[model samples]
Target: MNKQGTFVAVATSILAMAAAGSASAAESGKFQIKAFATKVAVDGAITKVKVDQLRLPAGADTRAKDAWVPTVAAEYFFSPRVSVETICCVTQHDVRGSGPLNGAALVDNAEVIPATVTVKYHFPLSSGVKPYVGAGPAYFMVFGEKVGASARALGATKVGLSSELGAALQAGVDIPLPGKAVGLSIDVKRYFVDTTAQFRAGDRVVLETKHKLDPWVASAGVAWRF
Candidate 1:
């Protein structure tokens, strides 16, 4: 099956298991699992140039393409108003040149794992809706970076992106369904992160630059509590 199909099957199985548990037990459950359809939008502008062997244009800039993927989160409630949450997902992107080098590809098929953990505060409301905010540290793990066609044409044989540590700010809301054990969740997180890209030809380093990869992650999904 495709990735989306696999994700749906996994989520459905988990939700079914949660539902099979006693309703009374679920109402007082401290754990929650969520499956989300997420969008990752990145700002991959060059912040600084460390080395310039390729003699790029003065106004050269880059942008990473946005991606949509499946994501999962697990949360443990410390109390009715407080919780700790972590999420798992992998996203892919390509960095393309902008401005002077418009339409040129710089990095191809770069994959990232945005590992995050957050402490959240859920506010009580008169209605059944729950609004929450969170803050946490995030680690961006980049891998599978390839030198793009344009870079290869310029004598680049290899490319690498360094992983970095950063911060995340989150805000969202949850609306409970008829059964309190299941709900709909909407979430948004802004990440403050950066990375260094290195381009190499054989054993020599051809170019190196720093980039701001701050991304906005938005998600909507179903949540199960048990």
Candidate 2:
């Protein structure tokens, strides 16, 4: 009712509002969304190849080129320190034959898509950076398999790859940008995937291969927290 009382009331309301905002910033909501440009490199060599159940010694040395993939992830925070994330990405690799059949003579290229789910633990630091570690399972689906011109000339008719299940380990850090709601994120992950490739001529199988596609995925991008 008085001038001094009115001033005190306004000041108290402003301070309370500020305190509520700060508390909200300190703790994120139940969900977050992240998008990233990721570069994935396949580090493991092909385990080996087989022809109609007979092993090909030279195919053991086959390799696939690295790929650049665009990726996205959605996360749900269960607590202030724990969250679950689901990530997805599609990548293509050029398969090169090795040893005696060295070159792109046997296999040309293939595309792989993976969906991964991980549980992450975050450590928030005073410097406005949050570091986290995660581990989980990944399911990979392979497609667009093709035999090279040389292999086709040699009577190859069809090529196919089987889907596989694997595990992944990841680490990342999020740095708050000038706007506290947006942040920069850098992440690195490794997926331990093993798959089998089957090559056929007519209705009969010809060459079969085992691929250890344990790849390292590195990404740098942004995330928004509500």
Candidate 3:
């Protein structure tokens, strides 16, 4: 199956398990499993490329377009107030250029997969409601790179982007169902990631620059504790 199909299958299985375990999950046990569906939006800043140690003129405006994607996460609680969680997602972006390089389409649909691990602390507010905060590290793996047709036509060789390491911060709240073992959760996270983008042809580098990709991920879903 394709990636989209696999993602759907995994999500279905998770929801099924949560439903089945909800009967025994409400009282709060040693393990708490939460499944979430989230949307990620990217806000990025691109620095100008330097050729032979000389920065480009003021007009070389290189930029990366924003992207939106779905993501999933799971949490494992070791204590009533402390837990560990991991989140993952894949996304694609478009690269563009202006000013000196007007009409330059550098890359299209480039893929990036981000995996994040975090430690969370849940506040003891009341039995049915909880608020939490978390912080962690994120690793980004980039692939499926393709040089845009416009760039290829301009004698550009290929597009290369370096994978990056970043950090994330999260804050959210959880509200349990009145009499069921199920609960609803809502959270938002900010990721600070930076990477280098390279455009090369033959043995020479055409353009190179740094990009700061700080995306905000907002999620809401269900959980079952057992």
Please tell me which predicted candidate would have the highest TM-score against the true structure. Answer: 1
Each candidate's TM vs. the true structure? 0.87, 0.81, 0.76
Residues 1-226, candidate 2: write the lDDT tens digits: 8433543454455345434544555455578788999998885366765554434554346667888877888998766666778987788887776676577456566888888887777778988788987777789888887976866776778878788988777789988887578889999987878888787889888777687888889999989887
CA lDDT, every prediction? Answer: 0.87, 0.76, 0.72
lDDT of 3: 0.72
What's the C-alpha lDDT at position 9 in model 3? 55
Q: Model 3, 85-167: lDDT tens per residue?
A: 88767888877766786657778887888888876767657686989877777898888888887778767778788899887
Model 2 residue pairs with clashes: none
Q: Write down the TM-score for model 1.
A: 0.87
- How many backbone clashes can be found in candidate 2? 0
Report the poorest 10 consecutive residues by lDDT, candidate 1: 20-29
**1 or 2, which is superior by lDDT?**
1
Superposed on all Cα atoms, model 3 deviates from the true structure by an RMSD in Å of: 10.5
Please write out the lDDT profile of model 1 over residues 184-223, one tens digit for every residue.
9999998888999999999999899999998999999999
- Tell me the alpha-carbon RMSD of every candidate: 10.3, 14.9, 10.5
Error of 3 at 44 (Å): 3.2
Ranking by TM-score: 1, 2, 3
